[model samples]
Target: MSGSRLGPEWVPGPDGLLSRHAARVILLDPSGRVLLVRGHDADEPERSWWFTVGGGLEPGESPRAAAVRETAEETGLELRPEQLEGPVLTRSAIFDFFRVTCRQEEQFFLARLAGGTATELSDAGWTAGEREVLDEMRWWDVAELEAELAGGAVVYPSNLPALVRSLLTGWDGSCAHLGEVEE
Candidate 1:
């Protein structure tokens, strides 16, 4: 496969897919609600989905640092790298966005809102590209999220509800690989 650059993090990988590594945050609030973002395909605006807060890691940044940075950029929730808990979950996903097929290896970290119940988020930190596709951000109770998923709303990490439920109970100090997800 040819290794060509689409951007700093995205490189062409096997089968011609753009590949990258990302850090995701399964950020929870004091009440146990998880923060998720709603975004649409840049090439197909009608296709949208809800996903956890995250993005590709910048050059030389560790997953923990990227998790903290992505969370802040996507939700205005600033967190220190040390505050991010176990990359509790890891998974590889292939999806289409902005008309490109991408294979992303993602690590999911758990974090709790420090000292408030407030869910208000500022979009001031979003990048120009993020602003083009990301439209909504909100906190969801696991039950409500499950209801939406059951009702057919599209969500990434298709098993998100279950994962959130498990993480809520507490991490076992082991990282779980979720295998590969294609969409």
Candidate 2:
């Protein structure tokens, strides 16, 4: 058999999957642009895509806490857990990575910032693994994202423009289930 497999390394938990939970942020600038990170699979660099900022939760960490921590680590912006609103969107996905096909459940929080809240996200803060795989981070307007989608570029969490528009109108403070997404 090949050394690689399309499943998580760990044994399936009671949930019947090697479940992983992630906390992501929909960070918005004053002008309402959303932040997206450009990254690629370490083993497949050509398969580049843009996605929100987040990672798997650490032991005993709540999703909100993880969101605040990850935002600071990935963007160099420190924010309180209270400042983040909603698990606005939740998504489930199954994909192959790091030699495994893993099931991931993600919770997305909305955090609006002033015109210049994010500082330069230099190499100083990136985890070694992230530094190797994450190419760049950008703030994108809805039109730009729509154009990319129309042009057949891959964007994660599926309906990105609709989601951002919902946030723009106002968050109802209820978690919306976004269902499954393909990676």
Candidate 3:
């Protein structure tokens, strides 16, 4: 078994699946480009995918709190919980990573950089396990992200482009459930 699943955050659900609750950030720049990270399963480095910045919620933490903390840890961007907008989207994702089959329920929040100029992101706060799996980070325009998906790049939440497009216009102040996503 891969050591990735050894963390206390990964617990067994009633179905015997490793389960996790995560809070994700849809961090955007002034130009509407969203930041994402590219990573591979520790046990399958050859297979990589692009995903948002966030992580499993710590014990006794609120989703909003977790989102703020995760953003700071993953990108070195300090943001107060109030700075984030709606848990814009929510979804359940089941996938294999680090040789472990896992189920994660995620809540995504949207936040934008304060200034027009892009803030330089830092990986200095990443945990050792994150450094091992995550290798690249970049901001992507919606159109470019759509193109990449169309061209066969693996991206989480598969509907991210459309989701971003909708959120770019504006969120309806309601959290939309994306149901189950198989990745």
Best by lDDT: 3
RMSD of each: 2.3, 3.3, 1.7
Q: In model 3, which regions exceed 4 Å deviation?
A: 1-6, 116-118
Q: Rank the candidates by TM-score, best first.
A: 3, 1, 2
lDDT of 2 by residue, 1-183 (tens): 122232222345465656578899998888888889988888877888898988878778899999998988888878898889998989888776654566788999999886666545644578777877889998899989999989988888768778998898779988888676657
Candidate 3 residue-wise lDDT, 1-183, digit = tens: 213454778888888888889999998888889999999988988999999999999989999999999988898888889889989999999898878888999999999776655468999999887888999899999999999999989888888888899988777898889887778
Off by over 4 Å in 2: 1-11, 14-17, 116-119
Per-structure clash totals for the candidates: 0, 2, 0
Which ten contiguous residues of candidate 2 have the minimum total lDDT?
1-10
What is the Å distance of residue 146 in model 3 from its true position?
0.7
Clash-forming residue pairs, model 2: 6-101, 7-101
Query: In terms of TM-score, which candidate is stronger, 1 or 3?
Result: 3
lDDT of 2 at 134: 87
The per-model lDDT (C-alpha) reads: 0.87, 0.80, 0.88
